[model samples]
Target: MMFKKIGLFVVIVIVVLIGVMTFNTFTNTADDPIFEVVEMPAIDTNAVAARLSEAVRIKTISTDVGDPPASAEFDQLHLLITSAFPLVHENLKRDVVGDHSLLYSWEGSDTSLPPALLMGHMDVVPVEPGTEGDWEEDAFSGAIKDGKIWGRGTLDDKLSVFAILEAAELQLAAGFKPKRTLYFAFGHDEEIGGENGAGKIADLLEERGVKLAFTLDEGMVIVQGMMPGVEEPIAFIALAEKGYLTLKLTATTEGGHSSIPPKTTAIGKIARAITRLEENRFPAALNSPASDMFDTLAPHMGLPLKAIISNRWLLDPLLVSELGKGGATNAMVRTTTAITITESGTKDNVLPSTATATVNFRLLPDTSIDDVVDHVTKVVDDPDIKISVKQGNEPSRISSKSGEGYQLIEKTIRETLPDVLVSPGLMLAGSDSKHYETIAENSYRFLPMRFGPDDLSRVHGTNERIYIDSYVEIIQFYRRLLENTGG
Candidate 1:
């Protein structure tokens, strides 16, 4: 009789668990929207591509932080903007913030409505020294070939600046004046820290007491074949950004010859510290933006994965394990550590007296710089090693997935792409959007550009390019966005 009771109890427990999982899985899809691709009027794709190509050719490369930018190149870019976008130049109020960053304010019919801001950077990172040969075209040539525009800034960002101005220019030609004020910001040093450019712009806006209703910049993209289980393209709009931290570690030890070396030299100590950092990594957690992402994608995913994600309350560990497998996906789940640079002995035979290493950490949203310092100190367990923060910031405050800024952007993306799925994600890298988040009610980071799996390495790597048709879509997306907000 006891065995019979036990069997019945087990069966009841299984039934209850299955019932809960099924409920969660079915309800996960309540918010998914289906839309038919709507037809739109055509633009001159060739002319737009030519303008983007011309913008890409000018090298407005951002030097290291605190260093002066390329003045001549930026001057050439400004001239191109003035000449290419006569409507925008004539109608908008332009301010050259911090010399290179440009801010344009377009007055609206109703000044009482809070203003909307659109931003993109004009600067591109320099091509790696030895990898220039690996590029299919000259890194700065902006060659239009094989149905694509080839160059550095073509993908990294000059496309955004051109797209915004082009969209506004077209809208103005159509005699469309916005109901809400609009601001266009083009920062020149976003590739570096953005301190002198976007940072100053944010400060200026704050000084003027200009409270922005919303701000949009680049962080996520419309990606294909990157996420598993979903066969269609995803418009991954990142609502939060991982914080960045650079820690410099230095160690000093007794000077000695190689033959009379102590048990552990300075270099050895630093190496052990790094090994400790790597081996004992930050604990993985299925945190927000990530959790929110899976929840949004769950409805669109395949069978077992969908079931698992929706029931994260019961299967959190399993979901974390699966998502933590890939390098890109792993970044979404936990803080990442990379030992970028190290220095030790001056000569081969001598024991080094001093050793230094540079460590870069991308902090998860819940982790702070102080928390990292404390963790590293405890894990390394070394008194002789001195750790100093080179530069860092806590993760961005999570933006609202349901905010007006996000809703408008999502609507614009859905209308623009029609077939793509939209989901909130965690941005793995930093962008100029961080600086502007302070003054805006909500700041969103999504570039309307579509990227495939193979395109990931090309951004700051070789053969960075954007398709001509893709550039056309970007212009369309921005135009729709402008129209949605106030055009």
Candidate 2:
């Protein structure tokens, strides 16, 4: 009788556990609002593509060192802007900030409401030396073939710069002005550190006592075959971007012959330090941006994934561990360490007195530079190794998805691309949006264009291009966004 009663209780417990999991999975659906589809007005897409191609042809390249490049290229592009978009140049008050950076203000009817700002960079990284031959079209040709505009800046940025101007020009033609103010910021040196361009612009705006409702800069995009379990294209609207920190590590010891080394050579010591850092990674968790993303997309996923995601209380450890497996997804969870540059002995046969390595870290939103320094110190516990930060910036603040400006952008995406699911995400890399934290109430990072898996390498790689239709879609998305702000 005791055995039978115990078996009955076990069976009941199993059934209840299953019942709870099933209920949670079913209820964990996306809270997507139904949006009415918008009809796009006929646009001269050919003209738009031609304009973008012209912009790309100008070699407005920026480098890691000295740039807001003192060249005639930026001047030529500025001339094109003034000539091509007559209405925009005539009406929107334009200011030349930080040498080559451009800022345009379109005064709205109402002065009480804070403004919305859109940003893009005009600078493009130079084509690598030997790889120039690998391109299907000339690197600066701006060739339009197979329904694509091929060039360096076409994807990395020129699209946003042209798209915003095109949308504003179109709206101005229709005699429509925003009720809330709008600003267009075009940074000239974002390819580098952006210290001279967007950074200065932010300072200037702050000095003027201008606070924004929101600011949008290009970062994430609509992607396919990237997120796990979801097959369709989903848009990642990055709520925050990862912080950047680069540390230079050095080791010093008594010089000696390679055969007659001390207890450990400098090279070996630094190498061991780097290996320790790689092996012992930062703790992983399904934090916001990632956590927010999963919650939004959970309902769209398969049953197993949905169950795992919804029942995080029971399965967070397993789920978080699995998330750290993929290269791209792994960056979404914890601070990532990468050994970029290393230098050792001049003559391989000689034991070097000093060895050095440069390591880069992309910190998660919650992680600080000092926190990273402490982690490295603890992990690489050798007193012989010295660590110093070369350059660093803390992560951007997480913007609200429920904010009015975010919803305005979200609704625009829904209306323009009705089929794509939009979700909050974390940007793995940096952007000019980092500088606008103080001047803007919230900052968003997204470009409404479809990107596939392989398109990742094409940005600064060979065959950099943007689809003509995609370019048109970007223009329409911005137009819809600007129209939505006409309260």
Candidate 3:
């Protein structure tokens, strides 16, 4: 009887071991599909470098609408586009909307499908007058050196415009035709808020009863050391962007001499209000596109981190707390507030009659401007301080993750960059796509390039540059994207 009991226990232990082995094998096999690389045509590095240089030389800097320079530069850039991409000009139907918006439609073989929009901006921000001396080469020179292309728009967005055209020109030369119609919308005033450019273009297309399958713009890029627990570089595709809100906090009291002042002056009240705002920030939640980013990257991460990310429901609060320790990661999970401008007393000796502070808020998705105003009002609590929303907008609608738009993007990135992991994220900054939210169902913001942290800082900063290899990769990415729209 003792021998038989021992034998039964041994059999049960062996059975349990087999079950564990099978489960591990299945899970490991599941991860294999995630790592498979896609095939794409070879990229032309020299052509990409030459084209980027040509684009930067045009000085398509955006000027204030009232200035004569604005319209002149817009027209020159438009002419340059036509002259450079002859195949696109000859094949696609081009239309000029508003003052400087350019729209090109490439008719697909199958007219039944909705068109895909490849959106970019041609105009760049103006450089500061005194900062020109800080550049390694002339900001407008478009110098190619040290294996990188240096210029103003190389990172902010001329890369997108140039890459899209280069890819289309190359594909047209190779006799490749897409099944779904492609529309290239280039806005002229994206830096100054895209009102006459992308806004008008989206309106024009909507009037024609056209609904886009998807619209891609410039926002996020590939980054290393971006997220914790991820060793490999991550390519963040922005599926949503936060809203911009500006608030004016004002405190009013009777003016008096500084020698005999009230216990709480206007400046004191305003300062206290700002302190409350900074102390009390919006609660972070794991929702929207940023959560999707972690979900997609989980399997690719190491064991302990992967397990935590894969089971986010059990560890979300803890994960958010951990991410909050870093500045970049904290921005991913919460609405952020910064006091940009403050005005108070006119004179040092006299007590000011009024004090005003301007605070900028980048609101998370699902957070309304009204909600933010209420939160700020509650936090300040003092009756002397008044909080009002000066300028505000609700966050843009989130794009679908499972739709044809996302899949095509993933496929394109996979083909062009087999090594990098693609994931969806929320953009912290505003883009021209915000203007199309009412009409378009899906709008995505991504630029195809892999760069480290320093490379990212160059954008909208001094010494903006792009690797020649990265430019070539972007060209291949667009080519694959146009070719695979039907498949």
On lDDT, the leading prediction is 2
Q: What tens-digit string does per-residue lDDT give for candidate 2 at 156-261?
A: 8988999999999999998888999899999999988788889999998899899999999999999988877898789889999999999999998888777877
Which sections of candidate 2 miss by over 4 Å?
Answer: 1-10, 67-70
Q: lDDT, candidate 1, residue 170?
A: 89
The clash tally of candidate 2 reads 0
TM-scores vs. true structure, each candidate: 0.96, 0.97, 0.91
**Of 1 and 2, which scores higher on lDDT?**
2
Extract clashing residue pairs from model 2: none
lDDT (Cα, 0-100) at 32 in candidate 3: 20
* lDDT of residue 73 for candidate 3: 66
- Clashes within 3 Å, all models in order: 0, 0, 0
Encode model 1's per-residue lDDT on 1-487: one tens digit a residue.
9999999999999999999999988888747655445445688888888988898889898768877899999999999999999999999999999898999998889889899999999999999899989999999998999999999898889999999999999888888889999999999899998888899999998998998988999889999887888988999888889999999999989987998889999999999999999898888889888888888888889899999988988999998888777688889998988999999898878999989999999999889999999988998899999999999988898889889888888888888898788999899999988898889988888997889888879998899999988888988888888888985
Candidate closer to the true structure by TM-score (higher is better), 2 or 3: 2
If ranked by TM-score, best first, what sequence of candidates would result? 2, 1, 3
lDDT of predicted model 3: 0.83
In the order shown, what is each candidate's alpha-carbon RMSD? 1.6, 1.4, 5.3
Please give, for residues 1-487, the per-residue lDDT of candidate 3 as tens digits. Answer: 9999999999999898656644443363123224245565676687678777878877878766545436776777778778888999999899998877889988888889988899889888878889889999888888999898989889988889888998899889989888888899988888877888899999999898888888899988888886666877777889999988999988999998999998989989989998989889888777878888877777677766666665565567888887765486778788888999999877878999899999999888888899898899899998888888888778888999777888888878876687777888999898999888766779999987787868866777789888888888888888888887733
lDDT of each: 0.89, 0.91, 0.83
Model 1 lDDT vs. the true structure?
Answer: 0.89
Q: Which pairs in model 1 have colliding backbones?
A: none
- CA shift of 184, model 3, Å: 0.2
